[model samples]
Target: MRRFVYCKVVLTTSLVWVLVDVFLLLYFSECNKCDDRKDRSLLPALRAVMSRTHEGPGEMGKAVIIPKEDQEKMKELFKINQFNLMASDMIALNRSLPDVRLDGCKTKVYPDDLPNTSIVIVFHNEAWSTLLRTVHSVINRSPRHLLVEILLVDDASERGRGNFMKLRGAAASRGQVITFLDAHCECTVGWLEPLLARIKEDRKAVVCPIIDVISDETFEYMAGSDMTYGGFNWKLNFRWYPVPQREMDRRKGDRTLPVRTPTMAGGLFSIDRSYFEEIGTYDPGMDIWGGENLEMSFRIWQCGGSLEIVTCSHVGHVFRKATPYSFPGGTGQVINKNNRRLAEVWMDEFKDFFYIISPGVVRVDYGDVSARKALREALQCKPFSWYLENIYPDSQIPRRYYSLGEIRNVETNQCVDNMGRKENEKVGFFNCHGMGGNQVFSYTADKEIRTDDLCLDVSRLNGPVVMLKCHHMKGNQMFEYDAERLTLLHVNSNQCLDMPSEEDKMVPTLRDCNGSRSQQWLLRNMTLSM
Candidate 1:
């Protein structure tokens, strides 16, 4: 019997140990799986880590990551794809509007005009039809003599090298001075106009023409949606909210209202040349292109000058399907670095918003921490409140209002007898209106219920008026008689306790007491003048 008992104890101990080992193994396996998911999710962080170590390599470093052969193939494929999309979209747009004239109307120019206006177009590898149509449209509508120069900045196009040079030469010979700026690195569009426009417009204010995009095949105006042109949210995310109906109705006859935006879409815009020079043009230190729009937009807004979308002017650009070239194997990292630079300079406290939206992404700290310090020093010209209220008014969103009737039933109970009931009577009743979620409250003959005391309990009301809890006090809680409307008014505020707005007041009787937030009252701060 003793041997059997010892054997049983050993068996029980073995079973417990086996269970422990299995649980640990399963837990460790799950942990490994979780680690794998985290690694995949943290691509942006991984890229950022890689960028810090890989800076000195420059463009070559980017190319070195991918095999040279793969890079070339990718470049070729991307170019082909972009060209195909542009060609198709352009063709479709043209077919849709076959009779669309390059010049709908012509403006006569006096010899004194002397070509004061300069049109600058920046493009990478654009389609022939799209590019030609843009030039043709400008030449046809603009006064021939006032058109001083057409600067075409060729952003290092790989495919249409010969054609682009030829077009530049032709425009130059036609009495339009054409200058092509070749950049070996990435370049953004819409930087040239603000500089040129600033030069023309008193050399003080910086401005750009409203920009629109052309459909790839149809050549129809594709962009300029109220939503897309409204700039971006803090997360570097873009959204276009529909114009309110009231505002739209007001704008029916006129479309030239000055729109204040946080940032301009980097497409086609014009700036005065003199003002452009004053603000130092584009930051020469910036890599070939990319993020220049953000830099220019923020600098313009921060440094006293304002940017606006002029409704009268419109310029169309071709939208590409994808980037034709990547920086070797590290295109994603390169772009991340470029955006980081802008975020660091302009975002300040809002920089964290970007990181939260795009986690694990690494960006180059473009404006050093001191850039923010410099911005602070430079921005001493205007109050931040002025900027928020006048310059960037879109930041303030209005509170939304919903009708009380839509949200709750406001029927009154004819069955309940209240002739002798006291103000603080506690009574349970069924809601006849079947609006189950609203609050119900009541006021007594000697005392009136303050808005704060109105409890939002839905179960106590017999009818639509939600039975809410209310504090009843002598003299302060009762309503004054209104001879004209037969309505009750609170003696404290002299406000008709159950009246709606003037538009809704014309009805014979109040259907439901509208409970607007404005109607709620606080009695402690009140001064009651009998």
Candidate 2:
């Protein structure tokens, strides 16, 4: 009986130990697997292509070549992940405003005296102080009779429709056209006036207003920073500056000169009503506010219209915090995906600049797809060069500098200027061309002695000739070389020298020693003035 009992106890002990070993192996395996997955998911280097040709299905009747491997990868990558499909809860919006009245202000009517201006204010959860100030400022400063309408476009606010109604009633009773547009999206101020004013102006100008920033917490006024002001750089990169010059001047007084920008902020602007609808107002496909400005800005600029900021007009707005809640399954990704679509479509050649500026942030794949479609449908317009040359003639091109090749040691025959020259003087100049055939010419005097190299003892030419004294051998010897026309020009005489037909000729012979018409070259300065 004792032996049987002992055998049962031993069996139970062995079974418990086996189970413990199995559990430990399973946990260890899972941990290793997790680490492996993480290692595989590292970020890739940002490599993007700016192809001249658009990628899409080939023309009708043409055989379309689709790579099987790429097709499979696309299918797998695009498979809807249920876990990623999540939406953010709606944000609470502020709708209350302090009771502020513009007393003794005469209200104006429309029809007989239509307003030369209609200020469209769009708000989500704006603070009371700023909103009222914006309204009051317009009422106080604007010509009462000429002020046509104050249209407030409201993105559905938790402040309730009642508040908007009361605000609307107050303005209406004053004999001003006060209309409320209820929406749950944000728009740039730039969209407002240009659209309304342009519609009023020509029934063809699709204009949008500039978006300015306002604060909610302090109810303090802040305008859009230059960082948010989008414009094209020399490289054709669409860049954002923090603030506009006008806003900066408001605080510091106008120190800046007026300049042209490719695109204005969409926060607070005006446009004509008729043209807004004609050109198809805001893109309907865009979700509740984000990149609508970019879409509108590009559409207006590309489609036979222009955008500008009225220097005299100003409005204040509140810049808000980022959304806390996300859409179901991460639809915000879709919104981002849409932005790239808009950029690709409008920016085209300059789209690569976006990636170069913000690497790893913008997904190039999806944007390329959308841009390709837009490019195919878009009406071919003038090249960017044409716009640079004609629309903005004053725009400056940066100076280009290059080094002069090896110079052979040559003995100086004569020194006209009394400056002394020591032995072994390095003589070279920048061999480069400038905008409008101008070239950079520079030369350096010897270290120990100062001597000016002159020909025929003539320091000044009576005819149309400008002499430039330069230091640094390469700098003074530098003349302009026109790669386009294959001409070498002297900076002083502005004359092209005749080079031997052989490509390897070192020095070209000038047609005339005297400043003749053929020798005189037209010099144009292209330095950026602003």
Candidate 3:
């Protein structure tokens, strides 16, 4: 009886162990299948054709040709949507985007405790299909638990509900953070997580997604490769430039980390609701659209908050040349007035440079800046100079320098002037004036000789030495001032300046660096003008 009992117990135990192994195998197999779907859905570069030639006269491989009869409708739609709305609808947008992130970006795991977000999409005159698609895309893609609400602020759009754009404000929202976006854009998968995660790390950190471009014509989603930081010219116009060497070096070649920008493109970004309100939201005096981006960036950086662009999140925007909406005042007038307020409130002594660049604004009424100025003092924000020095040292205008004057030939004593000169135009010496007029130049620590939006450059082999728009990178725009030789040597070509013959219309040529007197240039007098 004991032997029989032992055998029976062994058989029962063996059967139980086999059942557990079978169950584990089935569970893991199902998990792997789910992972496969996610892997395919995450890579936009590998999905679909990605190359769509649906608009105008063009063809991509296996193009989904738009019928000739549909061309006029497309033109009308483009005019309305400021994007290829027709194509956006036709393309299989129920898809993924190429993971436009650095290798390191994928390594991060967003915290589960991220704050709820409300997406605010403002539209003036937009297409219904694209607008609805945007709403649906967010609803479908975003985690339902994390998204508090989606607010559609229509600025009197006549397209969908006819009068939706005129709606003043959205209904009540429940989100801790609010994201502002244009109506004509598509959000990629895993977009909201990264943005919300960063805000969770620091509530005062205003963050932006890596903005990708959706072609206005082709409607193909284009990935933005160069992760350049946003900056502005002296005119407060926004521009994207390569990462400064110093800033990049701090990363140690890690592209996944968030990049600090002096300014942002302004339109599409996420901010803490309280921080936005606390830091004084868009200047109420400002017009419908213009200079608001720079204004907000300045306010945030100054008022104990920070702004950054998160590389992991991606959103494709339709960059249109002409906005569909109309400004009550002329667009230029509104922009000038808005910028005038920006200068008054934050620019400090550097505001004088505004008058020098656009003297008309000095006369035009910028409205009362007393309230904005008072707000700045109340916040006890850092001065614009501190922001410039600490945040953006690569800037050209009003930066650090020992000399600010004209590059003059010792023999002729003529100022190097390139005003109104086109590419390859010969740079000639004009009389030096103390006013630091257009001919006046500034020699920066980076060895760039610049003035009036132009930099000293040389074209192809032995080409005319001319003034070109500053590229702010290593190229013709970069020059080496050999103080020992007293000559301007082109960094890339290793060629020194040479004026073979002394004539009024003579174009300087680049020749071997033999250190000739014609090539020698000296800073006659340092003029303190930018």
Candidate 4:
């Protein structure tokens, strides 16, 4: 009986081993099929890991190079956005950027209870990678508790009024402060603290960031100069000029101190929520985006507020050569209309300077500015002259001038024209157009024959009349207009401005003071503001 029980146990054990072997073979076959599917599906994720590991294109703010085979395709895609779309696509959305701040800024500390901000980003059909990158950079860099939320505004309405769109964003915000940033920008490390800290100290302070350059072609990040600030030309166009010596002295040569700028680029800034509403958020009547920056700047300064550029804050912006979006009527027409509204409401008598610089604006229908004028009056704002005198003492616009009109040569019947040239370029003479623009010249109390920010300067005996930046210093730039003789005499060289000859390349020249008609000139539409 014992032998029979042993035989049965052996047979059962053999059967159990065979079943286990069959089960193992089936499981191995299914796992091989699953492995094949995962290889195909996870290829993109694996590449992403490799890219991060190897430091991919545009990593660390470096420029991205396009392969030879992709050059033509890149060119074609560039037109769609007026930027290097192909290169932007190759960059990771959360790409790393260098810490491009001053050494002092790196160690700066902020209050733990700093005011939280609701960032307002406005865009109209921007590229996917750039837009996402902007959002990601902001999220990654800004302190979570300090950032309430980001409101992405779609200003792509048929009217496409950027001012109105921003107003909507400001209205919807729930944070203590409202920060406006452009759609194609990257926030650098510690960019938010300095801005909010300033506002927390002074609610009426509207602060801006030092905007760095992000190359539109190579997708490379570049640091902009810390020595520049925003200013406006006579035509109300925004410009960047070097920080003056007076401002540097005020800061005591500290690179980390906030810069007191006359105007802002209007793209990236932060303001207290209640203060924004109290001072009037923005001109709803303004169209699209053109003169809003200057409008806000003037209103802020005149209405008991300060505009500043915090030096410790740095943000990268993509500077495109041309805009990709279309203007409703025409680009020039829309901008002219917007400028006219701001000039009429905020510029006071100085509006004449804008009208004279851009005569075409005289004909544009700027809609009704009665409401804007009412806002200024309600705020009991200071006059434009006060702004120029107290805030922007170095303004290009002369407070006191003998003449504000055209300078025409009697013999040639041509006007002394700027010809849209820059500083140090030869001054040209064009047929009198009667309309202001390049023909306008201002003989200031300082005795400088100026056009816009340029002065008629000639140091050599018979050198080509050149346009030097009005130095306010009375040396080569000093000129005396002999109203009796109708001659313009360069005081330093004692030479008169003569009409250009054929060999002069249409550029005016300086000659010994002669009473001849070639040296005689007249000021058309001249008005005395002295």
Candidate 5:
């Protein structure tokens, strides 16, 4: 009886062990299936978990309307970041943004073997909500396998500037590519693939997404124009101009194709890790954030690499009217110092134009740029003339110009001023200040008297000398300055740019050419390079 009982116990124990093994096997198999699903559709899983559809503040990229009671509070807090921090706090961290891409972009297919990237975001005392939202949006929208890591570089200085933070992040980054993004930005769907794909295809290509605007007041997502590409004024401030017809024809009107840009907005872009290093990354000598975008843009184009804006990719950034942060040496001083370094290194002879436009920059001691100059020499980069003629043919900086400086009337001793005006505004004369800004003008090789992007134009006889957008066609914009006669003859109007008449004390007029003192003008500091 004892032997039979022992055998029965052994059999029952064996059966129990078998059942436990089968249960464990089934559980692990289900877990493996889940892992597969996550690997395949990680972005969708994130969207399901983090994205919300119910109507709320900042939902679907709609503007968040502040209540009447909160207007005063909102205004008070807006000064902190030059943005509506209160509205940002109210919005969900994972707020949904609209897919602001063209239909053709949506249908496009990128290579499956695109390289992974490490996003480097540099911030100094950035708002809590906007900073975190930038992170969450990236994770929720980008594919998991494609985004290796997100590096938050906080180079907050007591002086309220960021210095060499990006270099530090690049050194620590482990991904195949490094993408730099602003602290207050939102990544949209499929933003990663196109950027990475372009870098994979040509490692030398530095690509930027079309940056959309997030309203500073109400936190509304507004689509930026894809037709616009980056350019810079004479002050080296980045500006957007329409994509030239030459580029449109080159791409055969395919808006989805990458547009060759002269410069980038500097906040968001992607570059291959090895290629970035090979191209000699950001200039270490550059202080804080100012002309780094143009510096890199010139470096890329001049050093046999191409800079482009991938239209298929879109990211949203808060466009602030002014910076809330402080500069150690004041904003103008810091920016001037930074820009002077770029001009000294990259602009070559073109540096004269910058100095001629911003005469004050000559006094600011730009630190040593020998290393940067050495880098340029080592790269065997093309000259600035090549860049202007080939890469940015339509650049506002005239390649060949007869004169660049103040246009002063001999009699009134007043200078022809842009008056800080926009297109079609009547051009006025102000007391010659000798300081450049509103008084500066360039007599270009194209025979247009240009200031920034506008030219002195007069279409009809005795028409007010107005500042019009410089049309290269030069119908009414053409002017011939007779150095012997000291008169500027209008080509189309058959008149000269006369000084402000007794009747019109502020506005300059176009009258029939006479060698009168009012019509007599001097191109101060004129260089006969033309």
Candidate 6:
């Protein structure tokens, strides 16, 4: 009994000392802050940015007159880390951002039974100010009852075993829900409630906030459009697309309703812990960050789970041009390797389309996918085809084209170009050589000649051949190919692709199909040849 008493006393004394130490530390911190205030009357922007004492400061449409020294500082920082780190440092940690929420969203209320979330942040060589600013944003803005813990995954800023896995394991004991965010992001006032509310309704729901852009050039918290959702092309690169009418209709006249997404843009999202593990977390094999976003989206959708973008919840992220950290064996190699793994495991027979679009990826050794394949089977996940059919109905599935090369007039030897044409400002034919560059084009099974996202457009009959953004909606963007007749026909305009034989006619114009040699084209395949 006496020994237990002694141990209790010792523990009490230790606790007392810890409390005293904390007290003293906080006191000193306050003293230091007071000293700082005395040193310099607070920065003018602080009143303007933090407390709305002076509003409309960051919204400087024109260049704010920055000092020469500040400009030099920004330039130096850009060299260090492709983003304006200097400007980020200048911005207050608790800078007030304009409430970009729609009027319909403000009255939305979440249930009291919403599960608490532990926001997990991972970083490598991130700016100290920005990282802490993110943490503070969550702390300040989030409801205390809803936020469980904030997990930080450190990749060691160098080669390490698995820092993300380690952080995930650590956070497991703390919270039921987990959110992964980049180190350099800022959250708005009501960003947490909507995400938590949605996940509560469906534990399998992987929800994301509408990502707002924190400008890399200037440290502006730029508002993002709510009318967009995450999407991807055949290459597995994430792109924003306008929210479809089908999705908008489900909202039932409410603008604040969550959007069902085809894929995630990556970077920021929240997930239920149990559901994440059941879905088999991340493919521990993925190195760094590239194709993991699409892989996870495919996994979630194919495995009886749904991914949604909670329009009401919003967060700001720094969109940097180039990553600051170093990657072993080059970033391109890692990304290609990762993509190859995804294609092999998830894409099945359709994986060849990815190789068709990006031939370099075919050569990459994506390591062993036996384990991932087994995992997919073990989960009894639906095939990727199902995901393509139901979840992403609008996605254009590319098949091997009968001809994949430059669309060139055999007579003039000039390739069809999308430039020197005003319709797209990127439409025209340059000098034709066997060498195909932007001239390189491919005809898809859907009857469209496309290079990346541009589709050959026939806006009007007898108009110049132009290239417009590919919507894949079978409107003016779609064209019908008659391989047997050797006539390229426009479905809507009901005109044939013709190179006018008239002298000084530089453009490829639409006209009646006369079976003329000027209209006939050759497809030289090797290396997208003309």
Assess every candidate by TM-score.
0.45, 0.37, 0.71, 0.89, 0.88, 0.80
In lDDT terms, how accurate is model 2?
0.34
Sort every candidate by lDDT, greatest first: 4, 5, 6, 3, 1, 2
Cα lDDT over the full model 6: 0.71
Q: For residues 284-310, could you state the per-residue lDDT of candidate 1 as single tens digits?
A: 434444555665676677777767654
In order of TM-score, best first, we have: 4, 5, 6, 3, 1, 2
Worst 10 residues of 4 by lDDT: 1-10
- Residues 370-449 of candidate 6 have per-residue lDDT tens digits of 99899899989998888877888767554445666567776677777655333374356668654444555777777787
Off by over 4 Å in 4: 1-54, 526-530
Model number with the top TM-score = 4
**Cα lDDT, model 1, residue 385:** 41
Q: Which residues of candidate 3, in runs, are more than 4 Å off?
A: 1-65, 92-98, 157-172, 401-447, 452-454, 458-463, 468-530
Clashes of 6: 7
Q: What would you estimate as the lDDT of candidate 5?
A: 0.83
Candidate scoring better on lDDT of 1 and 2: 1
lDDT of 5 by residue, 1-530 (tens): 00100000111224323322332333334343346544435334333323444466898899999999999999999999999998887787778888999999998888878899888887776775687678778877888778877777665445644537788877778889999899899989888899998898899999999999999999999988889999999889999999999999999999998999999988899999998998898888778889989999999999999999999999999999999988887889988999999999999988888887887888888899999999999999998899999989999888878788888898889888888899989988899887777888988888899999999888799978888888899789998889899998998878988887788888988888877898998987643221
* Candidate 3, 1-530: lDDT as tens digits: 00100000111224323322332333334343346555334234212322333342212211234679998998887776566666665654333445555666667888888898888776554564455446555765678778776666544422222112212222234478888777767787788888898898999999998888867776566777546889887567888878787877777766776788888998789988787767877677776777889988989898889899888887877787777666655667777888988988998977776555555566667788888888899999999898888887766575654356557776566667655466446666566554444555667776777764567787666656777777777588777887778888888888887663444344556778786687888864442332
lDDT for position 428 in model 2? 20
Q: What's the lDDT for candidate 4?
A: 0.83
Q: Report model 6's TM-score to 2 decimal places.
A: 0.80
lDDT of 5 at 219: 93
Model 4, TM vs. native: 0.89
lDDT of each: 0.38, 0.34, 0.67, 0.83, 0.83, 0.71
